[model samples]
Target: MNDTYSNGKDVIRITDVKLTTVQTRRRTGAISSHIVLQLSTDAGITGVGEISDLDCYRMYMPDPAAVKMGIEKVALGQNAFEIAALHERLLAYMPSYFRYANTYPPFTPASQIAAGVEMAFYDIVGKAFGTPVYNLLGGRQRDRFEITYPVFQAKKESDTERYLGYMDALVAEGVTRFRYYVGVNFEQDENFLIAFRDRFGDKVQLKALDFQGHHHWKDVLRIYDRFRQYGFELLESPSWREDYEGMAELRKRVDVDISEHISSLAQAMRMIRAGAVDVFNITIQSGGIYQAKKLFDLAEAAGLKSLISTTQEMSIGTAANAHLGAVVPQLHYAGDPVGPLLYVDDVVTEKLRYDGTQLIVPQGPGLGFEIDEDKLAALQAGLVEWDRPAHGANYVSD
Candidate 1:
């Protein structure tokens, strides 16, 4: 109102921020949090945004209080229209954000602080213009985005039966494609893939990954062939994350299209230069909407596709990724926007749903989602104050 409105674009000034930690009721080790930024405008148009979780690649979980404080320090009194400046200021305050955290220098810390801020900035801008975030990202190329559901890695014959039975419920809900990471063993994992092909092969799409990355190059080659025979589309992270040389050689050796699990943008460039990766399993949390879109463009420029990957986030993160995924034209593979359906419950009110094989992107302004106050309140009420416990797979019970 003071000087940012000389150009008639400053409608909102930052007022307050809120953080809520929600724990899963039905799952053992799956708990995620949310950060809400409330922007109070001179015109009384309150712009709202929710921070998506970015804990999978972080060395430590983001303290929501710290993120809220960071946001206020960077965003106070700034014009909401200055999205780029806001992000650049954020970068200057803390440089080198990660979709996944890095072990090197010249990089900022890896958490959802920047991502949450980015989403809120876009949300304010979108509502001011009466448009969606995808439109802000150079317009939409497609209406719906394809997704891959996470099936628990089955290691036994009975485990395969249980996986099938679990998928049966999802199939009824119109899910046609699903995937899971490799458990601990290959032979046991092979039996699981064979079951999917034998049972639901013709009815649904299939994808598999070995994120454990324990297999040798020869082992990866042999396993890729075995699963390819069963009609698995892509094999992801079959080896270690830094095995670029091995991945490059394997890409040339096998018929399976291998994807690299990228934590840093440099990792992505390395994969592209090496001609190793077939697709990118990227999370919006890796670098937020801006860098992720650029990464997708880089992949398409190199004749590959970028899949908006995920690892158990709430509806807010899923919605954020969906907005990015909606605009990208190269999202031609099974995506990991599978959070709302992954656990027993999500904290947002209007959670995303999968109709058949695709995820329907929310069409509202900004992230296109509203905070489920009732759900949030309930989660807050039910939250157990636990000390730092050993964390494990979100679905796997310890």
Candidate 2:
């Protein structure tokens, strides 16, 4: 798209690029790191983006140290408003890393890189036009959205008590929905669910988000039967993430909602055809913001519910998700962009605001957060000491 604003002289050209790598700690003491992208324009406008470290998909994560030169090659000296063409160039120029995972859609780390770049470009465009990124995508659909608090697997009584404490605090602040990890120790999980319902009562909602879905459909049915009385509205990935047939079989056997991560548009379609899931959990990691919109659009067209999933991103990445959450019509349920609330510290000058369970969509000109350059520099300096893989924690449970 060409730059055509009310003022003929509003065009901005990207001049320089900077990539800052930063790491933050999750509430559970897990390390969460991101590569923050900054683009400087000739018109004195700067845009920011973030590339998050996805836990299970770490093998597919591109080295941030190596991504800068590639970004410079594709993004430098371009008209800042030609984001579509810029995105095309980015996709063609960056490495896709398709062989890292043997999954259905294949893990493409390049998409994450593209997403970071696209996020920066969208920030620049929104700033230039003096509007929020959601307005640029479409008009705002909702000012605020619901969010589900993530609670890990409770292995013992103390674990359950600790989680209950967290939930009580959140509930006092207006949070009512929670998601727990299952498929681990069934007896402990059952006990935790029982305690959870007893503590919060039926006014609160619970859902299961499992990372290990290696069980057979019959086994999954048994697990579901055990937890059915607790009133779980949804169960995500009861079978393997890509096991559409198995998921379809399970869906037929139970009335509880099922959800799967949409890695690609083709995967969503396949799942839809198989009647596998009642919901599709999408994240910016699936591609960039635009690609996520496409997947959500597809899910809505098929009459399936969708929610914005998280990769445990910090403020900037969460800001981008906030904009998506604002415009996406199918995002009817609670999203998981709990980074601003969960991260110990963030690179943004002011983290996104969280009110109870809802994350208020940023209303500023760009992705709505400013970079903390000093913090970014500090994080980069300490990168050599960290083995990211060794410090990584599970997204659902650890």
Instruction: Pick the TM-score winner.
Output: 2
TM-score of 2: 0.88
lDDT of 1: 0.66
- Sum up the clashes in candidate 2: 0
Among residues 3 or more apart in sequence or in different chains, the pairs in candidate 2 whose N, CA or C atoms overlap within 3 Å are none
Tens digits of lDDT, candidate 1, 27-88: 33346444454555554445555454332323455566676677778887777777778768
Candidate 2 weakest lDDT stretch, 10 residues: 97-106
The clash count of every prediction, one per candidate, is 2, 0
Per-residue lDDT over 255-310 for candidate 2, one digit per residue giving the tens place of the 0 to 100 score: 87887777676777788999998998888866678878888888989999988887
Q: Quantify how close model 1 is to the true structure by its C-alpha RMSD in Å.
A: 4.1
